[model samples]
Target: MSATTDASRGKLIIPVLGRLYSSLHDAGETVLRVVAGAFLTIHGSQKISNPFGAAEMVEGLGFYPGALWSLVLACTEFFGGIFIAIGLLTRPAAFAGLFVLLVTVWFHWVTMSQGFSGAEKSLLWAAILLFFVIRGGNRHSVDARIGKAF
Candidate 1:
């Protein structure tokens, strides 16, 4: 091929590659959202069913208003997970999860000698949620399908 043709082909390749990368990112985000939502839901369920235990655990860690905060966290995780799973109000749900994670990191993490510890998991989830908020749910999501229908 001529140099001009070769250069044009190379330019096309970049756009194609970018599109492929974007598709892969969307797929990955969907999978991550589903998995994380399920996991957080289950964890929240455990706390909801045993609020006293959750409160006690928080109290043990010396958190003020332990019971209230425990309940708030539990509800946020549970409902936010559900919203994320269905891709309904995904951005808001993600924001909620991110907020919870930020508080957990600030209040619970800074004092611990272990530094990150278990809070790392929540922090990671928070990052994922923020990504979802920015990128949005994929075509496979309820939001995509239902949103268009309405």
Candidate 2:
């Protein structure tokens, strides 16, 4: 359709897909948020259970006070994931997660010398967290229910 026609339909370029998107975009975003948060939580569960299991690894990465940094990392992943999943304090939680993802990106790209191939996943995760850090949560989130965000 012409640009004017599409615009009149409340779509910019593609009215058919745009209408579909308008209907389900929020649900898609919610699913993305929940799934990403759940994956992060799962990734941290083992570390959180042990609490300091990553001490040596963190120390190797030059995070002084290995045990402390390990615990912090664990909490940042585990609890931050929970918060993000529930949409409670989403921006802060996502910001924390973004930091962790950025560290992983650095580790994979620089520390391991793995380059883009190895760092790609971390980069993607970082991007996702960065989105939440900027966008906070949606209407389906706890933040919305409680009438607060950030």
Candidate 3:
């Protein structure tokens, strides 16, 4: 009937729900970090094998010194992914990843005219990176261990 009646029956619904929610929230962030980090690392592996392989693509995107941009892209995705995975400089890494994903979003949307079909995954990844940019990898990260995150 009332809150007290429920407590007397040994059922504290609010406290139970609160604890469950907190646990799930923390665990969910860990899972998100792992998935985003591992996947990005894997995706970058091909380009990393030949850092300049994407030069033509970068040139086509109108970035000067195609080789340089290509190298930047390769390292950002590969190393940034690792940083994000370890929660080391998580915000910066996620921000860089966000930049890369945003470029892909624009490329897919405007250059290719593929819209959601081509950009959906990149958009999702960008959103996740954006989250990390704001949250800084949470308490489960290296940022937390070494010091309080910025």
Candidate 4:
């Protein structure tokens, strides 16, 4: 091919690669959202189903009014996870997950002084949540569907 043709081909390739990368990123975000939502939902179910256990953990964490915080966290996890799964209010749900992870890191993980060990999972999830906040959900999301209908 001529030099000009080669350069034109290269330019076309860039956009194709960009589109592929964007699609992959969106798929990964969707997976992350679903997995994180499911995990949080299960954990929250445990807490809400057994309030005493949650209260004890809250007390151990030295949160004032342990029962209240436990209840709030439980609700946040349960409802937030559902919202995230459906991609309804995705930004808010992601933010809620990020907030929960921040609190978990500050209250539970920081005390150990062992960086990214026990808290690594939460930190990873927090990063994923932040990503969702920035990118929003995929086209499969309720938000996108609703947006198109209006």
Per-residue lDDT, model 3, residue 146, is 92
- For 1-150, candidate 2 gives per-residue lDDT tens digits of 356545655744655676666667679888889988899999999989999999999999999899999999999999999899989999999999999899999999999999999999999999999999988889889999999986
Estimate the lDDT of model 2: 0.90
lDDT per residue for candidate 4 within 1-150, as digits (tens), equals: 356545555688465565555447667777887887788788778766765457777777777687887887887788888877878888888788788888777765776666768788888878878887786767768889898311
Candidate lDDT (C-alpha), each = 0.73, 0.90, 0.89, 0.75
Q: Model 3: residues >4 Å from true position, as ranges? A: 1-15, 148-150
TM-score on alpha carbons, each prediction: 0.69, 0.90, 0.87, 0.73
User: Which model is ahead, 1 or 2, in terms of TM-score?
Assistant: 2
The sequence of per-residue lDDT tens digits that candidate 1 reaches over residues 1-150 is: 356545555688465565555447667778888887787788678877865557776675566688887887788788888878777777777788888777667655775544688478767877888887886666767789787411
Tell me the spans in candidate 1 whose CA falls farther than 4 Å from its real position: 1-23, 56-66, 117-119, 148-150
Output the worst ten-in-a-row residue range by lDDT, candidate 1. Answer: 1-10
User: What lDDT does candidate 2 reach at residue 85?
Assistant: 91
TM-score of 1: 0.69
Clashes of each: 0, 0, 0, 0
RMSD in Å for model 4: 5.9
